[model samples]
Target: MPWTLPSRPSRRSLLAGAAGAAGAALLTGCSGGPGTADPDPAVSLERRMRASSVRDSERLLERYDATAAAHPALAERLAPLRAAVAAHTSALSSSGASDGSAAPSAPAAAPAPGAGPAVSGEPVPPKPEEALAALADAERSLAESRTVALAGAPGELARLLASVAACGAVHAYLLTPTPGAAS
Candidate 1:
């Protein structure tokens, strides 16, 4: 008989075994299955709110980044605003509210900073003035959303949201062009 090593279990079998183990764990509630409920509804609600705020902040940052990329002239002006949004996202994520179970859905798409209809994927290059205006509008909207979420947040989270809202408001104002200003 030819000398041959015993055939090892196929790769598919290994993957199946691993998946089966994971499914068993989930079914047994070892990883907080669907049957599990949060101990405190209020806390759960607060976490959801925080997660939503983080998602909004992240969307705002993406808008800013897209605008800056399309119109390099505005990059310098948008840098600080982007930094502020990034800080808000970092704070919210670090607060333990970004766990997958409670994380909010991401925005469907980030619109280009332009007057025409929003296009997904490839963004239309926008003029500097229009881009800035769009960025300001996005910031204002995010700030409003954050303000609404503040009511449900814990003390520390509330304070953080308040500061983030204030910063967003300031960024919106700063992004607006002054009358008679060069484009």
Candidate 2:
């Protein structure tokens, strides 16, 4: 006689086996199941910051582009700074992150009235030197923003913010007066 194979398990048998396995899993879970099911707060905060930074960078680039066009002299001084921000925005986008929020056409340019740092009463810069000094001030303020944003960021966002801050610092230095350079 030909060897006879055991019949395939019926649907009922398969269901019974599945149920048994599920019961065992449930019992194991009830005993000490993989800790709590709580979500990570850091992950959430990091996601928010990462997204916000992307949006801000995008908006700032556009703003600088527009401001640069409107004020050619200011724009000339700001070109490199704006370019750096554009690169940051591209990096954020490439990293598969960005806040969906549309930044306001004009982000808070000067400090809000009585918010924090007050705008100087000193006369506005009449030359590139003066403009560069002002640019340095703006870059510093942007650095502060990056710091605050990163304080609560997590994972990749924290890393990205650090990079952003370093870039801003570099921009500030670029705007500073070089030795032997005319003010």
Candidate 3:
């Protein structure tokens, strides 16, 4: 059998191939990166979630401050947990998309210098035990919220939120004392 030379491609076929390639590139480039005319659906959603998480952490910090201020005796115990929450806030505040996908929303606003935790018409419990319980409840609630939010987050943000949520859950557990243990 004689080896045959390949035929020169037809202009019609070449133009069709180029057009298809261009269309695919345009579609691929149109992905919802931040600052695009048509933003990615998840990018904006992630930004909102991230901003909300940061604010939640900040608010929790306020609660810790208020609780400590109310019951000076518990300040030492709450210090580490409060510090962790602050770190969570910082982490979320600084998070940005690494996948060339997003710009996280603006950072959460700082609480006022003298501003105490937002009061829902209820003061910090007078008793230290009650105050600790209240703090634990806040931690648990926020952790639950964050966990629920994980489904909506992009990969990196989801991972960060998951870690923070787990930390919050741990904080809740630590705030409460073991009844069976001797003081």
How much does each candidate deviate from the true structure in C-alpha RMSD?
18.8, 22.5, 20.2
Residues 80-171, model 1: lDDT tens digits: 77777777787776645446454433333434444233332334245777767777777778777766665555555666666677677667
Better of 2 and 3 by TM-score: 3
- What is the per-residue lDDT of model 2 for residues 1-183, given as tens digits with 9 covering 90 to 100? 997644544445544543443344334334423563454664565566766777767655544444443345565577667767877876665433456453333332533222222233333344545556765666666766875555455445555666676566666667666665575
Candidate 2 structure lDDT = 0.55
Error of 2 at 43 (Å): 3.3
Arrange candidates by lDDT, highest first: which order? Answer: 3, 1, 2
In model 2, what lDDT does residue 55 have?
73
* Higher-TM-score candidate of 1 and 3: 3
What residue runs in model 2 are displaced by over 4 Å at the alpha carbon? Answer: 1-40, 73-77, 94-130
Model 2: per-residue Cα lDDT at residue 181: 50
Best candidate, TM-score: 3
lDDT per residue (tens digit) for residues 1-183 in model 3: 997643633445544543443344344434536665554676787778878888788778778877776677777888888878887887787647456454433323333333444343346777778888899899989977876676656666766776777677767767767655574
